[model samples]
Target: MTNATQAQLSRTAEFIAGAKATVPLIIGAIPFGIIFGTLAEPSGLSTAGALAMSLFVFAGSSQFIALGLLSAGAALPVIIATTFVVNLRHMLYAANLVPKVRHLPQKWRALMAFGLTDETFAAVSNRYLLQENIQNAHWFYLGSFLAMYGNWVLCTALGVGLGELFPDMTEWGLDFAMSVTFIGMVIPHLKSKPMWGAVIVAGAMAIATVTMPHKLGLIVAAVCGIAVGLSLQLLLKAQAASEAQSR
Candidate 1:
């Protein structure tokens, strides 16, 4: 094969690998997406609006919170602010991946940024951590992003259809699958003291603030967890530096 053809094949293979890596997370998110769809109309969102949120916003937790607020007759500003706070965790995700993608062009960076969901981030970060096939890694990121984005949209549409047939479908509590999936993703990564510290602090904060309005507890937990993680990391680095200097 020619060089160009071989390069094309390599990109395709990387993309497929990325998508395959995200399959477990996608399975977990399916019921969550469906639940969002089932609850959307009952929570005062039109079918089009529901689909638009999945298409455009593409943030499951924020969408669910926004739906609840809409049903409660919340103001537009309130919905926007609440969801914005809930999604601030994405900033950290972006920060973690910025070093790896900084050399890419603006267009590529923008597209990747738009498609950066939790599942995609987890899959991409793990791939980057392994430092495997660095040249075509972006293709892998794209594959994971598209797989998750497509799956979410399809599941949402399915939920919308199911909602029409069974108006009470949201009451079945199928959303727990997502919680299990998140736990599975996070547990494997807690291989260090900083990670364990962050999880512990975040869990405590989440429980303590569970009764807060508009699900603000989630934001609080995320902030606390990030702070704890960063502090521990810095401290460890400083200790290592001091030890090296003494030696």
Candidate 2:
């Protein structure tokens, strides 16, 4: 094969590998997407609105929160602010990835940013962390993003259809799968004191602020977790520097 053809084949292989790596996450999110669809109409959204939200917003937690707010007759600004806060975690994800992706063109960066869901972040971050010399790694990121985005949209459509036939589908408690998936994602990454501090503080804060309105407690918990984690990380780095100087 010509060099160009070989390069194309390599990109395709990387893309497929990215998608394959995300299969477990996609499975976990399937029920969550369906649950969002089932709850959307009952939460006062039209079918088109629900699908459009999935296609456009593409943030499961934010979508669910938006549905709750809509059902409760929240103001437009409230819905926007709440969902925006819930998505602030994406900033952290982007920060973690900026170093790796900074060299890409703006259009590529923008597309990747749009596709950066939690699942994609986890899969891609793990890939970057574990593999130091990957070729066309962005292809792998694109593959994971496409797999997750397509799966979410498809599952949302399925849920919308199933919602009509089974109006009580939300009562099935399928969202628990997503919780398990998140826990699985987090547990494996708790390899340092900073990570442990973040998790512990975040969990405590979440429980403590569970009664906050509009799910603002989630934002509070996330902020607290990040604060503790960063503080610990900085302190550790300083100590390490001091120890090296002493030696």
Candidate 3:
């Protein structure tokens, strides 16, 4: 086969591999999507609106926040602010991936930016770390991104269709499963002091601000965690530089 043909095959394989590898992690999101679908209607969203959220907003945490605020009759600006705050972490994720993907054109970047989610990031980072020599890494990214996105949309539709059967789906406590999934994801990666510090600070702030109006504590805690983590990282880098110069 020609070298060009071989490269094309490699890209295709990587994309498929990425999608397949993330299938298990995507399972973790099923319950969350279902819970969102179940909660959406009772939270004052129509079935179409729920599907629209899954299609457009696409961020699980933000969608949940939107639902909660809507259920409680929050104003539009309040709902927008809370959801936006919950999704601020996406900016960090995007920034981290920029060095790897900056050479791509604007269209690819835009698609990638839209597809970057917590689950996809977990899948992509884990795969990229292991497959350092792989060609067309973004193909894998797209694979995982599409798989997770497809699962979310399908599961959401399922949840909405079945939502009527359970009038009090909120009482079912299914959303807790997502929390468990998140904790599982975080626990395995607390190997560094910076990570531990961020987790502790974020956790404490979250608890302390638990009763704040309109779930504003979620925003405050996120900002606190990012700030603490960033500050620690910078300090560590400076200290390392100073030690090197002294030597």
RMSD of every prediction = 1.9, 2.0, 2.8
Report the candidate with higher lDDT, 2 versus 3: 2
The top-ranked prediction according to TM-score is 1
Please tell me which model should have the higher TM-score, number 2 or number 3: 2
lDDT of 2 by residue, 1-247 (tens): 9999999998999899999989999999999999888888888999899999999899999999899999999999999999998888889899888888888899989999999998999888878767786568899999999999999999999998999999988888888999998987788889999999999999999999999976778878988999999999999999999999999
- Deviation from native of the Cα of residue 161 in model 2, angstroms: 1.2
TM-score of each: 0.92, 0.91, 0.85
Candidate 1 — which pairs collide? none
lDDT by residue (109-161, candidate 3, tens digit) is: 89989999987887788666556663488899999899999999999998997
Candidate 3, pairs of clashing residues: none
lDDT agreement of model 1 with the native: 0.92
Clashing pairs in 2: none
Candidate 2 residue spans exceeding 4 A from truth: 238-247
